[model samples]
Target chain A: MAEKKVYEKTLGVMPDVISGFCPGCMHGTVHKLVGEVVQELGMLDKLVRVEGVGCCGLGQQFVSHDVIIAAHGRACAVATGVKRCSPESLVYTYQGDGDLASIGLDETVSAANRGENFTVIFINNGIYGMTGGQMAPTTLIGMKATTAPFGRKVEEHGYPMHVCELLSQLKTPQFLVRTAVDTPQNVIKTRKYIKQAFQNQIDGKGFSLVEVVTSCPTNWGYTAKEALTFLREKMFEEFPLGVYRDKDKEEA
Target chain B: MAERVFMKGCEAIAEAGVRAGCRFFAGYPITPQNEIPEYFARRMPEVGGVFVQGESEVASVNMLYGAAATGTPAMSSSSSCGISLYSEGVSYCASARLPVVYVNVQRGGPGIGAIQPAQQDYLQATKASGNGGFRMIVLAPATVQECVDMVYEAFELAQRDNNPVLVLTDGVIGTMMEPVVLPPMKTDEDIKAMKAKFADKACTGHEPCKQHFCFPGSVGTGQEIANKEAEKMYATWDKDVRVEKYLTDDAEIIFAAYGISARISRAVVKQLRAEGIKAGMIRPITVSPFPYEAFSSLDFNQVKGILDVEMSIPAQMRWDIDHAVQGRCPINECRRSGGQLLTNDQVLEGARQLIKEVL
Candidate 1:
């Protein structure tokens, strides 16, 4: 009973229910962060979330806020529309690696370039979680998946897209930070940055992104605990974590 | 009162959107309909509005969905291939029942099939372009002037029904220049009057409205509220189907067409009248609520033959006409596809052939 009570407080506004995500999924952790931020900011009434296809696609379903499910690879564009149309509504998008990096690259870069006033929570879990472990754009070089059984060869398949570095080139996008939630200490920092991104929108600042370096235990062929160690050791080396852009401080 | 001016069909559509009190325009440029964005790029700013050249058609319609979600009269324009990219947003708008206007300047399809005009997207525009059992009110205009005129009706019907409305014009109607009269522009005072009465529809939290009167929690779980909303959409579509009839009182054959093809059919009707043969044309302005009753009102006993003028090889609209007639008259289809438009001469020749075979 005490353990249940402790977990209850952490969820904030996330309803307690069985979700489509696999057990011990990092999506649950990210959703909790999103819900806590919404509750803390008092934006539950005005929140308009656009969810895309993936494991995190179901993030909106767990939260107690107004939500709109966008077509795959189109969440950012939809959120851009929503924000421009209702400048007052707090708009955000929850997308996965495949939806953001591969199919919706144009929408992502352009929205960032134009400085669309919205928040984007990108879940980068190496493999495509929803469609069975396919080769994602972020699939580490020489990593095996269903599509790339031998491994993602750098010479043949090209290098993984450094979306953070690509987005950092854009002059706009007020806040862009990449963080991981594998550790409890890192999870707290991830929550802080995610909240700050939404707060930037509330402050009428431009586009903000919180790219979460998450885990795919089921697809990555590892136990949930081992996946956390994999992210810390293998993934962080390839995609480093930290703030890529902070325009507010840059101007100062 | 209607004012007349020589204008390209695409320009007329942009101008009509303005007259209809559309304050938001988001679109990406595509062939055969690029003029629409250019027109709005200049005109929207002049009218104290926002015009975004979206990164892509997907972005544009999502932008449209955003604007429409706020109850603003918003629209996007695209040619055939670009319109295909907008299908996802269209489906969401349908599910949400968000009122928006989409202008598809029809071009050849299957994948960027030339920039020339064609009526290949008839089925796509009329059927549910989105998910579930959702439908869009498709308005097919026959002329540049009607492109402007029908857009106004499209906006009106969409808002009144709280559903998405499509203005289906071919590349011919979009590119061809013709004389048109712009509707009277709404003044600041007019907007103020509308705002005073209907401001709640635009944004929430107006004077702390009751929870029951707010945004719906999900899609289709509510009872009386959802039913009442759906009933309003259905009733509005039923009443807004517009059709034009020509010389149908004592005609032996009737021609069915819409958009650019309808214009050609009208010319064929005139030629048949001159040749001492009784022929008429029935033009459907609203393709979705399809004026079945309007076409059925024609005396089929006297109508010995029917011809469908189309720009598709498979005879799309002719199917609708056949359903309307219910095997009452001998029907034939005359069509040209892959970016080819039927000429007045070609349509008349088809009519003449049909008349000889039947009469």
Candidate 2:
């Protein structure tokens, strides 16, 4: 028998195109995971992707769905609009830490609190990757960023935000999970968490958020390998990987 | 058949929105315009529409952007400070060419000015609504009826132009009560059909569609191309320029105004005409596609001078009047600001003074 093809690129993705993200940025991986999940769930035709600022905004170019780019940090609000207006469509916002936790904190919290029936795929890479490695809301203490030259200090800059933890406290969000994409196992687990978030939306279970701990090698001033190690060793310490809230599992 | 009901200006505008098939509303509470959202909160659900009292003006406008991107008739309203916060989202809407409707119930301002009715935001509404020099189709309504009517028509104009439209009223019109014949409510099927018609081009997740919706950087050549397209769209809006001319054919002096100021100016014209003064009024219903043509058509040789009446000190509409008159006639301004209403007598006195200057 002829060899059978097992794995192929997702039909929800544009083929063989270079995104505007920096080299080795995990935004591409997250985008791929999202595209694959959408394709697997037979939601390719029903996916409305709302893009935010920073490198994650480039997901609009790579995703083969209807994508609307929002103003900086306004993706969650925009996604809320899309989902509410077209309830049959699966709408998701792809945002960076700066876009979600910084300028968009109010929108993020408000959407979660409203229990908006949509999915949020938050990429937390500890630094602002698009504007040349500036400090982000998720940036770890002692992390070196352009905006934090002296390295982040708890007294000066405050501690890095734990978005999953913060959002999980809200009663409205149906699912809230924190996952990383640094290793093979972690990447698979991250994909699973993201799929579950999308599935929650499909099931009409109001807001679900998957926070992906990502590596920004170019922004972090490290090689791809070093960045992966840093994500596992340092970043994971501040943002531990686990499901913070699962309404279905909790009820069961 | 539509029923006549005495409704507040803000409530009427909200009713008009629902009647026009506006299925999505997201707004923040602001003085003078709070009734808009409050009305929508009760009425939208009744019509099977979505209503979200957003976290802030910023969030509400962006939410409108999201809903409008799906080609849903979405609207938002705010007062001056709140409108300022919506600027960024408005620009995004323009960049994306989404037909969104917004209302700014004008109030005294340069900052957190008084909440009293004022026309201080004329320049902001007409000239620079948002960054990148995008112009919205700004409608100035002088009456509660016009407010309801304009808010009803604004959705069509917005959809026709594929841009955001602003219904600019003052706190007076927003809070005042009047009998208005509301338009018939849009049936659910009509709204669905409209959505289906736009689903192909809209970012509503329908398949066999364009991959990208409307992001400046994501599109070809970034915002430069999108902006160029927007400029082209703006050039075609000359056909939409609207103005109401009263007794200007044989008049020697013309009073230029809009919104509440225009309402006051109309009364002033009637009073001046009764007093045997050759006074006429030119009211711009669409302030952005301003009545420049109206000024140009006037027999400048026969005209004595143009008096610009406004509720803002130092005048904001005067610039458009000056541009329209183009030195053909001397222009004088009669204005009040800081939430002070311009009385008809004040306008009458100012017009008499301008007539004296030209005579």
Per-model i-RMS in Å?
Answer: 5.1, 1.7
DockQ scores for all the models shown? 0.28, 0.72
Top of the candidates by TM-score: 2
lDDT of 1 by residue, B294-355 (tens): 66666777889899999998989887887888888889888999998798888888888898
Where does candidate 2 clash, by residue pair?
A: none
lDDT of 2: 0.88
The lDDT leader among the candidates is: 2
Query: Each candidate's TM vs. the true structure?
Result: 0.88, 0.96
DockQ of model 1 vs. true complex: 0.28
* Model 1 chain B worst lDDT window (10 residues): B205-214
